[model samples]
Target: MKKLILVRHAKTEQLYDYSKSDFDRKLLPRGHKDAATIANQLKNKEIIPDLFITSKAKRAKQTAEIYAETLGYNPSAIKKEQFIYDGYTTSEMIKYLSQFNSGSDTIIIFGHNPDIAGFTVNLISDDLWHFPTSCTTVINFNIDSWKDIEVRSGKVELYIYPKMFK
Candidate 1:
């Protein structure tokens, strides 16, 4: 089985940063956070992903860094994939991933939403899902090879959203 954790980046700035290009917008302070402090979500989960990949966008990168640090993963080992920031539909992203990183049993990807949320919904069910900032969903695929994964075949192991914290 393959495990995938998808995270939509934390709240950002610059109308939440609409004027800012999607690639460079940074995280907005959540009250006293004053920075990206979203580590707690991954703490007790013991999430040590075999491969940690993130969009090159500033916000996504920052969120990935926080999760990596919290999980004791080597920050530098995290890969920055520009294509993620560029944007791709659910199937395109899945094909891209299957082509390159099939060796990993567990993979974590940090990226933006509507796309991220859309992919998760396609994986677990046909129902629509709203993926908020800092949202993290853990999905377990029954296939041994990522290339064999099918839509609606993924089982959602856990789904965490920032609202649950505050």
Candidate 2:
């Protein structure tokens, strides 16, 4: 069984300019706090991934860093993908995931929605309920290879949000 954790980066500041617009938006103050809470929850729950894949965008990178740090994961294990920055569809995300080495059983993808939301809803066989900011959804699947992953191929094992911690 392989595990995939889909994380939607926390709230971000509104885009202000065209210069590096999508890549420049940083996490808001509340976003940082909420991300910290979610990171701690993942740590407390002993949810550790073998690898962390995130969009090259600042906000997504920051969120992945915080979660990896709080979970005591090596910073080097976190990889940034340029495709995630522009890929807004589930098929694109799945293609990226398929590129990973088959040895990895658990992986975390920190990215934006509706890509994250769409990916979760489309890949998992169960209802998501919610995929809000700073939320994490864990999906488990039995596949011979990552290339076999497709829409609604996995089961929703868990869904968590920062509000649940309050």
Candidate with maximal TM-score: 2
Model 1 is weakest, by summed lDDT over 10 consecutive residues, at 31-40
- The global C-alpha lDDT for each of the candidates, from Candidate 1 onward, is 0.78, 0.85
lDDT of 1: 0.78
Candidate 2: the clashing residue pairs are none
Q: Please list all clashing residue pairs in model 1, or write none if there are none.
A: 14-17
Candidate 2: Cα lDDT at 29: 92
Model 2 over residues 92-127: C-alpha lDDT tens digits? 777767877567888999988877888888987787
On the 0 to 100 scale, the lDDT of residue 138 in model 1 is 89
Q: Runs in model 2 with CA error above 4 Å?
A: 16-20
Where is model 2 poorest over a 10-residue stretch in terms of lDDT? 15-24
TM-score of 1: 0.86
Q: What would you estimate as the lDDT of candidate 2?
A: 0.85
Q: Quote model 2's TM-score.
A: 0.89
